[model samples]
Target: MTAQHGHTADRATTAPPVTTAAAARDYARSVVRQRWDSASRTAREEDVVDLLLVVSELVTNAIRHGDGLAAFEVALAEDGVRLTVHDNSDAVPDVAYGRGELPSGGHGQGYGWPLIIRLAREVVIEPRPGGGKSISVLVPLHARP
Candidate 1:
């Protein structure tokens, strides 16, 4: 999917569309780096690590479980980093959007959602206009001393 822009002004700093999870992580790291470099208070290294993990989980889920990734965007917000991942499926995992519960089964395949829930805030899942859905979340960045 094409990148969705809320305002034309943001287009200049907006990251290009990424298809793979690795690309998404790289783009997200660059954003964090840019923000840290420019801001007086940089995000803690641990917080940045958490942000990368969340980015990986979101993009990987979209590509693996949500048909395929439609689009991906990472923006530096005042309080934290905002991530939006659009996929070609409308399905939303109940464990993620519902009670924020972890999967009960013993299978080793259900950690991503819980990990995301623990690391991110204001998690939202909404259906896109044409098709598929968009998952958005804010991974708060803590300032380092």
Candidate 2:
């Protein structure tokens, strides 16, 4: 990502796309590190973990239900980190609950979205203008600070 207008923005890492679940989480982690690594150097470690975990969950979901692998953008705005993942899936997510065990492959199972709603400042999904889906998740810098 080039330094534009003195601000670091989320850049599209590549074209084509990543199709594997493992590759998706790895890509998400890379974006988190590139964006949060800077100011996080002075912030608490827990905050960093929270952001990375959230990113992993969102990215994994996109890869699984959507078409092929997608892309994630992590931007360090003045207020907090803005994480957006774009996928080719048309499925919109909803809340579901059960008593079974968590899925071994997915990021979180057994109704883990509420955990995200509790941890993240904001979680939203909207239909992309063209043909896909986009999920935007905002995580605060620190819960205490």
Candidate 3:
């Protein structure tokens, strides 16, 4: 899957398969953090934290709930970051938690979608041309003070 952010040309990279959601989340976090940090010196710490949070939640959801992760991408736009995670399931996520709730998980509770919507400038879920689905979120990269 590709994340279109209208900045530098989108480059696709494959993350090696990992067993657990935690592993997937960690790998994705590190990859994006490194890339984004290198790509934009002006990106704020808060913005990178938000970017990582969104990355963790989305990739974790794909690993835990969707039919496993298919691919992941982080796109750096002129003004923001775009994150996309692809999985084998076609299910569209529902926002369960209120906007104010913290996104950390609980027993049989969903916090990712709501937190994503609350944090991201925009969120989109679209069906893959072949099969499955992709969830993408765009986050503004605010300049550090």
Report lDDT per candidate: 0.78, 0.58, 0.68
Question: Once model 3 is optimally superposed onto the true structure by TM-score, how far is the C-alpha of residue 22 displaced, in angstroms?
Answer: 5.4
Candidate 3: regions farther than 4 A off? 1-40, 96-109
Kindly report which residue pairs in candidate 1 clash with one another.
1-70
- Lowest lDDT block of 10, candidate 1: 1-10
Model 1 collision count: 1
Question: Model 3's lDDT to the true fold?
Answer: 0.68
Model 3 TM-score on a 0 to 1 scale: 0.71
In lDDT terms, which candidate is top?
Answer: 1
Spell out the clash pairs found in candidate 2: 18-69
For residues 6-81, write the lDDT of model 1, one tens digit per residue. 2221222445878887888888888767643353567788998899999999999998999999888876666678
RMSD of model 3 against the true structure:
4.9
User: Which one wins on TM-score?
Assistant: 1
TM-scores of all predicted structures: 0.83, 0.63, 0.71
